[model samples]
Target chain A: MATAATSDIKWWAGGRSPFNMEYGKLMMWYFLMSDAFTFGAFLISYGTIRFSQNYWPDPNHVFNAFPFAGHANLPLAFVSLMTFILIISSVTMVLAVHAGHHMDRKGVIKWMIWTIVGGIAFLSCQAWEWTHLITGHHPVLIDGVVQEIGTTVSRNPWGPDVTGMMHDGMQVTKTGPVAFGGYFFGITGFHGFHVLSGVVINIIMLIMTLNGTFDRRGHYQMIEKAGLYWHFVDLVWVFVFLCFYLI
Target chain B: MQHSSNTHSPEVTFHHAPGDSASTIKKIVRTTVILSVITLIELALGFGIYMLHKNPDPSHALILFIKGVIVILSLLKAFYIVGVFMHLGDEVKNMIMTIVVPLMLFIWFIAAFLWDGNAWRNLRNTDAGHRPAKQEQVTKPVDAKKPGGIE
Candidate 1:
């Protein structure tokens, strides 16, 4: 299938033969790949800190959902719902891109709108979680005495008792050097910023869709590109959830 | 060719416009459900582990093995989400490897660090055979005449 021709012979202009993609889009993917590695580094550090510690608290206990009045310990319920919302949004986005492929402007707009809504909902849930954490919703007693109350600081179990004797559960907390919190806030906060930005980006794309930008061009490539970015954001959250909430 | 280019230029033309395809919809839903079930199972295991044995000796081989399994299963779930839902499955083999390999290596590096750090913590906390140096100096025999003495 190597049909040699003048266009195929071009160095910079022709991408179909060698890369099967335009330089611009390919570069975006490349950047995403690298960024993914950076996020992976942060998550790995978190894992190491958790593992190195003796009695690290369970993520479910640390991140219980807050309903109307008192807080409830649903662990992954809110996050799981948020995960599905993002996934559904990704589906709609892909469909929108597909519609764009067929020059179906209305379909693109509709799906893009749905995708935007889902992104907003995700951001909203995250914002709520962050607010709750910052507000010191959960309380735990430190050691067998001092009561240290905060979102990040807790007397949650991370190690066994000093003696071989066991109580209700391992009562030690504060794993590693206690600097893990700084890393946790910085990494997860940066990732959350990306999710927030993604929501804004999708909103802008939705506006463009409504204005018939893609309709006139008869291509859905831009939508596909945005979908790629959105999916990556979701993928990062998958690891974040595991790092912050589970492992 | 120029005329055809203009017709689609500065805009994209749809060859097979996007819409809700039932097959794809079904696939996505199926994947989500499956992922959810796997996560639920993980939660169940976590709870079960917590209930059965909260303080098994930190150096127990079985406990470490179970923890390893949990971590591996979690990574597997994460991989499925990225590969299937994120379209990495459709990417070139090299590109896929490029994304996955570094991630694995970095996690391993972190795991090593955590293992050493935890061991250090355990050593520092353990008070093995330390007759308290001056235990008798600090301990005073309870006097029945004292106001707060246990009767």
Candidate 2:
């Protein structure tokens, strides 16, 4: 049975797959749907906490530093780079999938390499950002004492300046809500972990292509499946970027 | 592969169409450009919000409006990513529904949680929202040593 009875036969009969798609692809879609819920819960909770708080720290103030730009504030520059890298990677993955459909082994290899490279580049940028935030200390006024604090899960030193205080020619503020750091690291870290795994999966796909696995199977549907997964990672980042960086 | 009246059963032979290479490439390029442009607009809007914050007296309503626009643009980006890049649009109607229908829960999920969160804040402000407070701690004794409750 094929699509010949496209309108004649019953689709929900389930004798064969009624989705008219491969079972593997359907399973991947289901998995991505579940993963979406996971991220949705995290972001929604962050929103809830934010609404509950009387005051929240502005993201631009906290994420104002750039790499090697000492004392110069440049908010959203690095993350914008990260976003572009991921989008480019997604485009390359699409190319890989397209080439896979043609069964052009060389084309698939070339694009897959570029896609993996983009993934690593994004990850490297994220690593630098995490290191910078974790290690960069700023002066904060705590209980009438000047203390240096870096952003962590338990501390946020980006609160409003109540007194006319100065340290290193910068206004020293009190600690803001502690949940800020926790959610920032937690969600972004989880997303980074997904990117890492996606890279690994792409690597495996690359090796399989080089080893003639798909050629032997006489189909490149596996690449299509992996492409779905790759694009899904990109999809999640859209929301992540909006929640963390934009609003 | 024809869509005439006498079509196959779409079971084991329902492979996706691989159109002319040129058209396929063109479609890919178009989607890529669209995705990039949307991202650039989103970045511009993000900068807009930052500029608003820099103003001495930022208009909260305007900021909210810009945020709403950004979110709508993000949804547009997401649609391109999922529908074109992931080829979800090429899937069967039932398949797309299967994927999208479950996602509707997020609307309720977000609404309920944020509603409860805001309600919790109101409750705490009104002394747990149950009964009047005792005379003991209605107004705290102002601390002479610590102003603005630092730390």
Best by lDDT: 2
Docking class of 2: acceptable
**What value of lDDT does candidate 1 attain over all alpha carbons?**
0.62
Q: What DockQ does each listed candidate score?
A: 0.16, 0.33
List TM-score per model, in order: 0.70, 0.90
Interface RMSD of each: 5.6, 4.2
| Cand. 1 TM to true fold | 0.70
- Candidate 2 docking DockQ: 0.33
CA deviation > 4 Å runs, candidate 2? A1-5, A12-15, B1-11, B124-151
- Candidate 2: residue pairs that collide: A2-B8, A2-B9, A2-B10, A3-B8, A3-B9, A3-B10, A4-B7, A4-B8, A4-B9, A5-B8
Label model 1 with its docking quality class: incorrect
- The residue-by-residue lDDT of candidate 1 on A1-247, one tens digit each, is 1222323354334333233343455566777878887887676666656555555655555565765536555665676677677767777776676566566778888888888888888878877876676564222334554233345432222322345433344333333234444655667788878878877877888788888777666555677778778878877876676566555
> Lowest-scoring 10 consecutive residues by lDDT in candidate 2 chain A?
A1-10
Residue range B1-151, candidate 1, lDDT tens digits: 1223223432211111122567666766687777777667666655544444546544456555655666777777767766666566755455567566766676567767777667666665687433367545667699977899978
RMSD to truth, every model: 12.4, 8.8
